[model samples]
Target: MLLVFFLMVAKSVHRIGPTEVGLVTKRFGRKLPDDNPIAFNREAGHQADLLMPGMRMKWWPIFTVTKFPWVQIQAGEIGVVISQVGRSLPIGAKSARYRTEFGTFTDLRGFISGGGEKGVQRPVLPPGSLVPIHPVGFLVITARHVHGLPVAPEFAALARGGKLVAQSFKLDPKQLEVAVIAPHGTTDVIGLVTTLEGEPLPSGDLASRIGAFDDIVALETDRAVTDAQVIDILMGTKNGLHNNYQDFQAFLDAGGRIGLQHDPLLYGAYLLNPFLVRVELVPMLVVNQGQVAVIKSFVGLPTLDTSGEEFKFGSIVAPGHRGIWQEPLRTGKYAINPRIYAAELVPTFILTLNWANAASQAHDLDARLEPIVGKSREGFIFTIDLQVQIHVPDARAPKVISMVGTMKNLVNEVLQSAVGNHFRNTLQALEAVKFIETREQVQQSAHTAVTRYLAGYEIETKGVYIQDVVFPDELVAVLTRREIANQERATYKEQQAAQTARIEMEKARGTADMQAELAAAQVSVDINGNRAQAREAQAGGDAAYTRITGQAEADRVQAIGLAEAKATEALGVARAAGFAAQREAIGEMPTALVAVAGAVAEGKINVVPDILVTGNGSSLDGLAATLMRKLSPAQDGQPG
Candidate 1:
């Protein structure tokens, strides 16, 4: 009896695999009142609760258990949950209702009590997790992860289908620069999105509400997801701070409107759900350093008056208002969506538009303009190449755009036609060849007219230059012949002037030569006069020296004469002294007599003076004779 009972228990046992879940069905239970396929309470049908990976008893022929593999979501993957037996969606409701209080559908009792709508649910299962779903009420489907890399060909195929370039490269602000390398990519690329599944759009609205994560995960899995739906690009306060669709949910929560947005994805990579969003790469709006991007907005608040501001409104708004913006975007990079706002790149730099057949080195904007041609008053046809430089001030860029559309439109629609008409009309009243002679006046007139015309449109004319002029072939031949004759006449006049100059030069040279000879003669006369003056000065100096020497000798002779006379008187006194004293003094007279005789000998006197005779002639004669004899004893030649 024990062995039989163990066999019956073994036969009733059933097992579910580790990677799977089992759904239990109640056997021989009371029938449900509504008789629906699923019973809210345990009835003669599948049970409300699921059996997780384990063995169960009494699950044999009487009660059936269905085994299903747990939903496995890989890294970067998301699983969308769908409830099969929850409350139905209200008739007028847009989608399955979402309420954050229900704890992400993890608690079955809470979900049921919270009246979780029977349909798609919010809050997707994140990457790297397995979810156990009850077969009776819930089903989980694995949503493929979007690959940012190009290993998978889904994006490439979708890109080709939407007529977009499959390849993309990020411009590392430090990488390749546009100023040097120019620009790349198609001119018509755009952000194309096709929402496969989402909340239904409101009445009269082109785009549906921005979906949460669960709605994004519930995108269609097959080919229907690849269809092209133009996506509204993000813009303004939400521009790129949303991190290139990486933080789109936050953008939406921050009052980001749905449908086509005004901000575009710059050149780079993005991971987006294929079913929820599709991108069409569009051309970039490059506002170069010297340009101003005039913005014509199709969305924003009401325009306000700026009648007394630096940026006066001429159908332009202040920075944040609607209508055409007065303050333009200065030089820089901007990711723009063309559908929302039109950006006219008005060059704030010198813009030169050429009216000529030849292309200019400045820019290609004037390549198609034709040379100005008109008939003069004398019915002579002439052609002129004109270059007009214009400028739209940074503050006036939007005004120009409001008046016109773009720089090209301003040139093609307004300036080109106006300038051509003015030249055609004004030149018809001027003389053809004389127009070249007084060309400055024509340029001035052209400039003045154009400036006045452009002032009405808020554009500045910097300058008007007449580049080249082409005359009719026959007119050119006639002009050349007339010019050759005129040049010959000018040459004759110049030759006459040269001859006169040469004659004047010779006259000057002759005068200079005469002055040089006169200077030399004057120098010789000056030398002779200086020599004569030197000789006269020498003679005067010699005569003066002789006169001075003669006076000095006469004065010396006078002094010697006076001294001798005094000595002679003294000798006489001694000789005539009293008898006794005379004898005594006479002895000293001999010494005096010797000194007198010596002086007489030195003087070489031939005769003695009679005045020197004393009282008796004979005695004096005798004394004189004695002195002479004494003096003669010293003579060399005379006999003593």
Candidate 2:
């Protein structure tokens, strides 16, 4: 009865938080048959099953309970799980997909039974929401950010296949970021990948594409030494999606081809798995200004039938593929894989091809080429300075590159050889001395002839400049002597002409002196005769003036008398007409006088009156007073 009571008291109870989980362990439990107590078992030591929140029962001082916070993951983060206790993982992606025994990390019993791996987990716990878990059951750890792991140097020794050579075969988080290949500068280059994992590269192919060349899987695959390998190769090419190689999982699922790609990477930085792919940076074929690059593909299809045109029967190719392309790459940058095509840069400018010992054009096609020397008809050994300007238009640059390989090749092989042979043969037809005089004609003929020849090679000869025609030493000396003799004869002839001109000039001067003396004598005689004639003419003019003056005076008096008489008669006639008109207007003389007297009376002047009247003054006053009285009555029209 007392032991039973003790047993009831031993049954102690405990509770857990709302979001928390309880990890309980039996102090004493079942043991395996014929063996000591197991450290971890279903009914022993640490129980695989976890206690739920808010409830728990345990024997007093026997069973133990420990509470743990749930796992919380924020946005844009992941929880990389590490199994403290579990089995190993299978080989591929779908191996641990349908889990019953290892039913995720939530259920410790299922996880133990599901055969989960003990190392870094393949699947990651995504962000958002908390995950309640037991501390003893499974250790739930966040990604590298949540927990600060030690960083390994990027210069860590790498394996032969480009994977990082792990220290003593340990799996670390740094191993996850195994390989990366970033482009350095603005130079264009392509990534050549050779995968060491996956299924072996197809036949002769050395690589494959799983996701990106630097994908984790690809890195893992590349890291595969014979012991721990996955796929052979994952290429950086063949993806219509996945934001470059950032989405590693998507790349692998897409099943990209693994090998040397046709298209190349321009200027940019890139992440790469060195173990998954071996990359070699090759320079781009640059087509500079005034030049064109012909692209000739080495791989693909059979030969095209170009026998009738610019190409031979077996050397035919399609444009931009198979063989030499008709359209060339203009002056610009091109990210072409050097392994696939051959480039021949043909200058499209007017190139001056020189064949002279001292020729120094910056665009010298062949610096090692010597000057052109030919034999004259007289067997004189002479050297010719030849400069031919040639141009290959944009339309024909491709044909030029294909036919003769390059501009340098054309200058060395076609232009130099043909021009040398033609000049050598034509030059022998003329003497060395005659070369200077006939140089213009020779240049024209050569230009015309070379143009036709180079037309077959698609090069147009613009012009040919004859810089110099150097003769042998002996021939030069002889020509100089002949020129001196010719100058001597010319000098003698000019002196003779000068002497004859001088003699004629002296004779003309003597004749001019004698004529000067005769002109002076004639001038004096003419001066004396003109003075005499002047005096005689003056006297005759004076007499004529006097006689005309007397006649004018007499005529003046007669004219004056006639004018005075006529004026007097006119004055009398005008006075008479005026008086007759006045009488006609008035109708009576006495009435006209009264009208005049009335006007005088309106303007009558008053005389001073004296206290004592003088008789003369009285008379004058009486006359004015009487006249005014009479005129006033008349003006009033009253009869007096």
Candidate 3:
């Protein structure tokens, strides 16, 4: 029965929390039967099963229950009674009774209340005498103290010499060193010595067995717990300064830790944040209008009409404002450094104009006045008659506002300088005719001078003309006298020229008449000569024709005469022969003879021979003679 009870109680044990475990033992070395008796089962063979918080087991009268504590434990009930052994208490035993409160058991070491102080000596036991004692009674042995009796050297040596206790100490701002405890064995056997005032354990003493008597023992400090409060302070302060208060509080709540180096109060004060104006200008030029006009002055001014004013330094002058004085106005106020700022002149002269006319008028006046003032060898005032035509190429209006002032001064200077001594002398010499030629010469000079002056400035000189001329009072008188004398001389020369022209005209007319007469005479001579030649030619032709005709007529007449002469000779010879023949034929018949003779006389005899040799020739000859005589005598009576 006893063995059964022990087994049941021994099995009715369990552990709580991580650092502790429970062990159960049996009474009288006996084991009981278990519900599940596997070899690995820790609760095998026992009616006292492993007891959890609410688990219950059958408790038999024959079995004894016992518990072996394997680690440290805390009793949870308040005001529970706890018995201390091997610990000395106060003289009043009842008043010195020990009690537990708030789940913690308080030590009664050094609890005496009387005037006579009693010291309790530490009891030294032989090895293994306090083995297997319950921790609740053994752990309270730290309450004992020693007094009165002189300590024996051997016992003192043994008490002081047993195991050495090590301690660590530190001071807070209050100069109180906090004690740290390190334990290696049973709490009842160990001792700690320290110098911290009012500390519960200046010298640590152990009330419970730790290990074997021969084994060296030591205390291990709970560093995490020992430094926890200080680490919390540092972490909290550091968080507050670093703006990490929330994180620091979380760390404390979660049992997180830090070291001394994380303190926030040790930081230094200096810290840096760092920053940059841009300038620009417009380009332009200015020109004068005189003999010195060839030189241009540079004016650094804005080309546009800008509301914002620009300042200039150095040699530049302010356009609208008074020039900066070299001296300061007051002690703290300085005249603006001449090298620092300047006022800008807005460029108003972009419009183009014809300035040539202005210069011409000035030149004419200068010429006329020079002689009148007896200053012909000096400079004179010239009028500048300008023909200004403003041309605005861009949308901007022509900037004529500044031009009026500029032109006035420019004209004055130019006229004064340009009408020099040489110009004056020339004007004086031609004083009488100065007015007449002044416009022409002035126009010429002005065009030349003004063009050169404005060349660099790029201003266009469209044209120039001499509009009018004016002479000084003195010059007018001198010029008028000179003019009268000039008019008289001009009149005399005109009359001489007229006479010379008339004489020349008459000479030319006479010459022309002489030439005409000479031509006529020559023509008459030619005509007469030609007539004579024609007459001679006609006479020669007529003579030749007459000679030829006379020769031809003479030849014709000679030929006819020769032919008639031969015919006449032949007729005479034939007639004589016929007459002879007829006389012979008509022999001795008076009538027939007469008839034949008449026929022969009329030249009609047909057969008459000159020698009539007929048969009766001789006889008939005589008869014919007689008949012819008779016939002749009869014809003589009628016609023979």
Candidate 4:
């Protein structure tokens, strides 16, 4: 009893530590206003004035002092203050309206006098703040702990049961710390903000723009504003006014709406009230090389068609309007809120699409495509692997995207039908052999047809190639047999030619073996012919000489014979004349006798017939006698 009396006496001169605040509750004061739980004029209930560090004089039994640890907000942490005592909040307001004089909710008197409401305060205790707030009038909730007295019955019961946590106020423990949008690295990210406490979002809009697109309207009205300039303007943020939702009063003052926010959070730490503002980290819109991002804005000015009447595919608008923008974002990373604006990436480079078994590694647009199968006029089925190269002009990407909705749609729907049907019809019309022979012509025709068809969609056809052809098994077998037969025929012809060549070669070899003997025989024949010719020439010369000599000798002999004949004739004539003279000179008989005697005497006959001419028989004697007489007479006559 004596110690209790000492404690009550010591309480009259209370001492508050440097890190503590003394919350004074007047035990016998006037009743507090019904609308306010705290007393600013020393009424009953909890007193709005806090006892600062050092000392305080509150008479015992008249007032009670309870010491509370000073609201020490740690680094990287914020304290959300809920005011237990103030004027009632206006309907539809989620938090207490804040005033400049409230000054971090440390001055309770100023907060009440400045029309502070009784609820969660608009401005929160920033990081590293050491504030001495009246513990009974306010509760500061942090990530790791909650500080202050529970005012309501349910809250006090929960606190008593150890269930009064940060989640009790619909807040995660980590949310009490500062919200950080980290710097972008390999894949950039952006924070999409969603406000929990603000005016409901306007109808027909998915998100809330702070100024409600008035800036975009002004930009759209300006004739000199370019599409790129409009995108730049839209990227500019109004986070400065609210200091990235750290100052919730400023955000409310600036007409911030609830639900999805148009402006996204860039790279930075923001002390946002978890109960008021929620951030969702999402991937930034990245338009890579060889691509353009066509923006379809859901939050912008009213839609107005910029594409002329000739374009019947879809409506195209300027960048700030609520439709597909004419200009696309070229190869860049954008920190755009995807909920408000949808971006479709359209490739501006040559896009090769294959109608084959394999899908392109660069894109999946042809993943579902397969080789075209068709029957020829001969009922032969054939499979064709084709490749179609198309180009989407950067200037016409928006129109092309609007026409087909996506590149995959262009491949699967439009080009698939155009190319597949054309090839099928073409194959069906042609015989298998004709199609094989005129494959190049078929490719050319397909290219022309595809070019014309894609031109209608404002797309360019770069090339159409027939990559491979898979003929039917029956056709392949027939072709293989025919080719084998042709090869066999060529082999037979070659064998026949080899046999003929072998015959000629054997003949040449036999001739070559007798070459020396043949040469010698030819030389001997030549020698014999030359000798024969020489002999014939010599005989001819001899014959010619003999003929010439014989002719000359014959002529000379004839001349000589003629001359002798003349001479002889003359001599005979002379002799005959002499005989005639002799006969005339003598008488007939006497001339004879004288001639006889002269003949006998000239002949030199021997007169003496000495037994030389003895006649045989009787005639001999008579002839002898005559001869004796003739001899005697001749001798006598010669002498005469």
Candidate 5:
């Protein structure tokens, strides 16, 4: 019993090891301030000064010493300091203001002299930090351990029950570690920063830019701001000033606002203070080939229209102004803060919009479009499957977006109405057959109309095509029947031609089969023709001979008649003259009697002997005597 008493007395001389901290408490002293749990003037409660690693002698009855492990932060972890004994925190302030002289809150006298308030400290203990924090004045909470003494009744109760954790102060264990915003395999990400401890954001601002767009105002005042200069001004950030919010006091000193930050944390690890800043991982903006990102800034200078007076749809401004930027981000990845800026991707290539059942795989602007349905002039309904190709020039993409708001809106609103209504009205005034036959003309007209319409929105109409035409069922049936009838008629005509050809072929075949007999008959006919020609020549020769003989006889007879007539004429002339002379000589009757006597003397006077009997009577005896004389002559001739 005496040895135990001696050992208890020897406990007055405390020996603190190299890895331990000695927290001193005054057994008898003046009362500490009501607001301060620690005594800086050597007054009551727990003393502010911590005993370092060494032998420290405190009288056993007057002082008490409690050994504690030094505050230790492991790798990939941070220690958040919460002050329990300092000046009361100012109203509306959630954390104590930090000072450079505080020196990580390791110097108790300096921290108290520097006017450190009592609450959570703004600065955090970074990974691998080792310090001897005052046990009663502050509490250090780490990911896996709590390293300071709990002086408050509730904290002491929770700590005794092993329930005093990093979460008890509303700090997430994950947040205590370093923030990583780097590529993981195929996923590239960025950290969007939101500061919890700073001055409130400016009025009418959704986010807080580093310089509050002062640079933007300067650029806007200058009329000769180039795109590269604008881009450089917009890319400037204040992250370097605060060491990525690892130094929260530096962030506050640099005029960081309490809201979403304008700039996002890029590809790196950050030691962000959980009490002051929170980070959300989001996908980095990727503008691919054939595409452009049109930035609409929600945080920048007051909008000043860069688009000319001719543009009335919306304000188009330079890159850093608070409106749709005229210049676009083309084909690259950007770590843009989504909360501060909205990026609308506009394809710079030709975009095909289909007013049909099909949707383009490259874009979804045409997904909601259907075939154009209209009625023809004859009340025939028709469905037209149309496709329109448009291009948004890279330079004009922002203007296009400003006018239409989005590519989908360009399809769904302006182009849809223009194309569909034009076709409907065109079909309403055109006959179905005429429309089908003049599809090319109609497509060309649609191209012209759409070109004219989209030109107003700064969109280039590449082409407009009528992909297919679907006629009404009744019209289709009628056309099919007509086509079938026409085809049948053509088939019948072809069959008739085939039959005529077959008949000709049969005639040729028969002619070929009877070739020898036909040749013999042709030879016989030729022989008969030759014989008939010879007979005709013989008949011609005989006719010629007979004609010559008749001609000669007629010529001879005519010559003889002409000579005899001439001789008779001469004899008559002589007689008439002789008579005339006789008449003159004797009387008219004596002339005639003389002519008769002369005629009798010329005939040998036979007229007187035979005529004497004939003139007297019937002359039967004379006739008998003449007949007897003739008979006697005949008898004489017969006898000779």
Candidate 6:
């Protein structure tokens, strides 16, 4: 009765709360009804009532009830078991035996024993019992201990194969404990064992498990290790190894894989391929900065070719790829023999011949090459007696190198064309002074022709000078003849000028002679007029003198006559007076005689005696003589 009462009281206690659910324990034969009053009841008086939070329940002893604590109300408690043997248990087997406070508990003995009223229980066993349980409820059974049980050897072997051996020896199994076993007992092994068993050991735990290179041991597991977890384990093991050989061995032994790195090696000697082959143009004129070098002119004639060849390393091994090689093998990876291989070949001049031909070839080459020569206009060209030096003051060496090929080809082509077409004519025209006028025109024409020929290039055409135009002997002779002709024409012009001067001088002389003759004639006329005037003056003076003398004589004679007459008259009067005085004595007779005497005296004055004296002449001879003497005396004394 007491037992019945105790059972009923035990059943009256109920579980309640948010996480709790009431569990009912009934007799084996009894069937609880679907509509039973206990299903809805919260009071402890029903067979089993769920006591909810804030709800009241009354304990009743009449019906038996038991409050089963809600196992779902607690947090999960996980347990692990490790085996030293190298094997894993079947899935869920280990979890079944794992004693978690909230999880389902396994009845190991119940599984082993046949069904009965009281199937299996934990208790102190007799000393000789085949299986034993530790006093601690949480103690796990391992394969080693299980092998020691009173089972046949075959049965033990089968048990080891089927159950004790790990499902995966290389990794830990899921939800199962792991065990690391080692032949040698060391702290590393201990740590590794602990770690594999899901007991949190220090990092690098598994790496320390491997004893030596040959050491072999079994680890137990039933599940796969996740990739992330495996990586974490490997990293931890690498850190532990850290350049130590023993640690490395331990890592390998613990199923750790190692990794490494390496470098490439170089091979046999060979030259590097040239990266850039530049063809530039050089101009005959001044080369400007950034100007493309190009061909200018060509000289002489020779079979000339301006083509260039380029070889390249193709496909990293073959040759003769041509053009600029941009890529080369890595220096460290490729060995280059500088002496053995010709990495770059620039054919500056290829043709072979005599000096003249060579020179001609060179000139032709220059025509081809000039196109690629880089030039700076800043530099000056210095020309001496026979040589010329082109000074490039501001030349860009790199640009020059780049342009060399192009310049060469241009120079060659230009020289060839120029010499072939214009050389002979230019030489002929340059032979004489007369042709000097046309020389410039010819040179300009040549330059224009050359420029037009090289128009495809980028060089400028500066002034072209004819250094020395060589003429053949025949051309020289022709030039000399022309010069002679010009000289003769000049001489003839000078002679004509001299003749004109002589003609003018002759005309001037003739005019002077005529003027002198006219002057002489006028002088003669003047002299004649002066002589005539003198003769006329002399005649007039003589005539006037004669007339005066004659008039004086006439007057004197007449006066004497008149004086005689008057004197006779006076004498007559005197005689008459005397006579009168006498006449008074003989008057009348004396008058006649006086008159006659006067007349006679007047006549005698004319060298004749007067007739009146004749009358007295008879007596007059004596008287006359006397009279003459007296008259002479008187005439001498008196003024008459």
lDDT of 1 by residue, 1-640 (tens): 8997777778667687897876666677888545233545777776666667778665455667777776666664454455654577777432355566654354555667787776555444555666665544554444332111111133235435443221222112211111111235434333533333334444444432233112223332333442111111223224355454433344444444545544455544454433233455556666778887877765543565553465443556544344676667766666665665677777788898889887768567787788988888888787878899998888777777776766777887888889988888877877777787888988899999999999988788999888888888887898899999999999999999999999999998897879878788789889988988998898789889988997898889888988998898788666445423633666544644555656667885545565555664676676678566654533453222
The candidate 1 region of ten consecutive residues with least summed lDDT is 170-179
lDDT of 3 by residue, 364-432 (tens): 322222211223322334433334222211111112112222333333444334433334444555543
Query: 109-216 in candidate 4: lDDT tens per residue?
Result: 777778878878777788999988877678899997788898755467768767467987778888998888885577688899998888887778888778887887
276: Cα error in model 6, Å: 31
- Decide which is better by lDDT, 3 or 5: 5
What are the TM-scores, per candidate, against the unseen true structure?
0.55, 0.48, 0.20, 0.74, 0.74, 0.20
In candidate 6, what are the lDDT values of residues 1-640, reduced to their tens digit? 9998776666565444553333332333244343222222333223332333333333443333333222221111112222111112344222112212212222323322322111011111111222222111112222122211212233345466554332222222322222112223321111111111111223322112222112111110213543233222212223234122212223234443321100001211111100100111111122223232212111111112222233221111111112212221111111111111113222222222111211343333332221111111222111111111121111221122234344343344434445344534443434344344575675577667655643333233444445544443555587789889999999999999999988998988887778877688779878888888888888889889888998999999999999999999997687545644654565544544554456567764333334445454575575666445533423343211
The alpha-carbon lDDT assigned to residue 222 of candidate 5 equals: 82
> Cα lDDT for residue 350, model 4?
93
- Minimal lDDT window, size 10, model 3: 270-279
lDDT of each: 0.61, 0.58, 0.33, 0.85, 0.83, 0.32
Per-model clash counts, in order, read: 14, 21, 40, 0, 0, 64
Q: List the lowest-lDDT window of 10 residues for candidate 5.
A: 631-640
lDDT of 3: 0.33
How does residue 422 of candidate 1 score in lDDT? 88
Winner on lDDT (4 vs 6): 4
What's model 4's TM-score?
0.74
Candidate 6 structure, TM-score to reference: 0.20
- Top model by lDDT, which number? 4
